[model samples]
Target: MSLDAPYIARAAKPGQFVQIRCNDSFEPLLRRPFSIHRVKGEGSRVKDIEILYEVVGKGTEILAGKKEGDFIDVLGPLGNGFILPRTTNHERRTTNSEPRAIIIAGGIGAAPLVYLAEELTKKKIKTIILIGAKTKNLILCEKDFKKATPEVYISTDDGTYGSQGFVSKLFHKILKTTESKFETIVYVCGPHGMLKCIVDICQERKFECHASLEEKMACGIGVCLGCAVKTKSGIKLACKDGPVFNASELIW
Candidate 1:
């Protein structure tokens, strides 16, 4: 869903999200949180912000029915965003010392990372993306990610397309086989099980990992504490503190 919100588009960063109200009525009561997929326009004149969502239930079903010109109640650019890699002096002059970054997306979680991949590519960082879904039809944003980097690997649980297995396993294989000596960072968004698996691998391999978590929220702000997550530093609100957190800070 593309929204004509220039203010949000200008301020939005990769890994931040928005909460949208499906209807004006109290049927759903709370809003639904969706990752800011991509921002449209260039320079300081952004025109619109886009969000990707699936019609899982009533709220999204109603959201799917919205017309293009329809006004939507959106509360946005929420939570902390991913920390992008800074361009080093050496990287500007040569490709030998360039940093490498990897993105792992599971199912609909592929939405937010497209923006991150684009930003990394613009900085000339070697960016790779691993996308996983249950089947080929469920895979999201393959074409969009390929625009940023050519190293897009895909896997499905049922072996319908690409590799036949979990994406986390594919990541492990890449980490093991790759000969690049530059620093590497991994960013991931996916099912809880997949996140945990990737985090474990990162921990064992000593690679820095960042994860975008998906959680239910009653309030998009810090109040209510409905979407609290346990981290190394105690409880943190997913809506306010983060939807993106360092893998080391997370408990599970």
Candidate 2:
């Protein structure tokens, strides 16, 4: 859904999200958090922001039924965002070769990465995206990602899509076969099991990695401490301290 929130659109960074009030009734007291799917506008003029969501619960079901031109309450551009690689931090194999970025998304997790991939393309970085779904119809953002980068891979667990296998398994094979000469970074957003597996692979490969954590938030702000994650440093709030965190920083 596209929302006419100009300031939120302008300020939103890749991996950042927004808290939306699903309905006016107090039945569902808390607002739901959604990643900023994409920003819509032209040069320096951000008209609106988009949100990609699944109707997994009553809140999202209510949101899904809202018509266009309706005013929805939204609290914006929240949480820490992804850090882009510049020349100083990222390694380059050769003077002419650019740094490579590998993005792994499972199901609706692909939502946030579309914005990131577009930004990466604008920086002229080589970006490859791997999207996983249960079936061919469950895949998200293939066309949007293709517009951003040509190198997009798809995997479905049911053998109904591009590749027939778990996406994590495919990712491991790719990492194992990749040459050490190329500098690569990975970004992932998915199920806990998938995230943990990918984190292990990245750790073993010694690749810089970041992950967008999907957690339930009671209070979108940090107050309730509802969305706490155990990190290497200490306990951190997912709603405020992250949603996006460096993979190394997480205990998992």
Candidate 3:
């Protein structure tokens, strides 16, 4: 849902996230983590920032009760964000045949990709999003993503939505059939099993890939050392060092 956090909207970037306090009381004391789903407005005068989530726990249940005028405590836009291509000169970028992106998300992982897509589209870089979910109702963000780019593909565990299978199958099909025409990089976030499969495909084909990981974060800053992941460079905190890391860097 959208929040009128102008400060967060102004400072947020793709792949970065926020930590929210669900209630004023101390019962569910620690805050919960969320990705910045969308950021709006212009320059430093940002108007809104959005977050996508599910109510599977106590914190979320409390959050669902928030009213229109209610004030919620949020700490963000936190963590290192996606490292978007920095080249400002599109002519040069296109001339160099800079790689296009393929964004893969499963279930709620789609949240961050929408924001990432907005950044890529503004840069005029092509992006194709692949989304997969257990059912149609669980699928998220297709409409918003389509507005950023016309290329979107979806799959479902049941045949209730787009294709009746896993999203990785769609990726495999593209690799087996039409991938030679473009230079590609993959950006993915999903269940651990799902991500491993996707990363394996990219690794075998030698495609550069990045992944956004979610961890139980405490003290959203680094001091807590709660969100560590084993990376090729060594152990790093998902909160301070990343929620995003190169696929190659992860131990998997």
Best by the lDDT measure: 1
Q: Put the candidates in lDDT order, highest first.
A: 1, 2, 3
lDDT agreement with native, every candidate: 0.90, 0.89, 0.87
Q: Looking at model 3, report the run of 10 residues with the lowest lDDT sum.
A: 86-95
Worst 10 residues of 1 by lDDT: 89-98
Q: Residue 172 CA error for candidate 3 (Å)?
A: 0.9
TM-score of 3: 0.94
Residue 3, candidate 1: how far off, in angstroms? 0.8
Ranking by TM-score: 1, 2, 3
What are the clashing pairs of model 2?
none
Q: Which portions of model 2 miss their true places by more than 4 Å?
A: 88-97, 176-179
For model 3, residues 1-252, the per-residue Cα lDDT tens digits are 789998889888999999999988997999999999999877777879988988989999998888887899999989898877544445333444566789999998898989999999998887888899989999999899899999888899896999888889988875676556556778898888889989989999888788899999888988889899999999999998899988888997
Model 3 residue 235 distance off true place after TM-score fit, in angstroms: 1.0
Between candidates 1 and 3, the one scoring higher on TM-score is: 1
Measured against the true structure, the TM-scores of the candidates, in listed sequence, are 0.95, 0.94, 0.94
Report the lDDT tens digits of candidate 1 across residue range 1-252: 889999889999999999998999998989999989999999888879998988999899999999979999999889998987657755343445556798999999898999899888888889989999999999999999999999999999999999999998788788778876766789999999999999899888777799999999988898989999999999999998899999999987
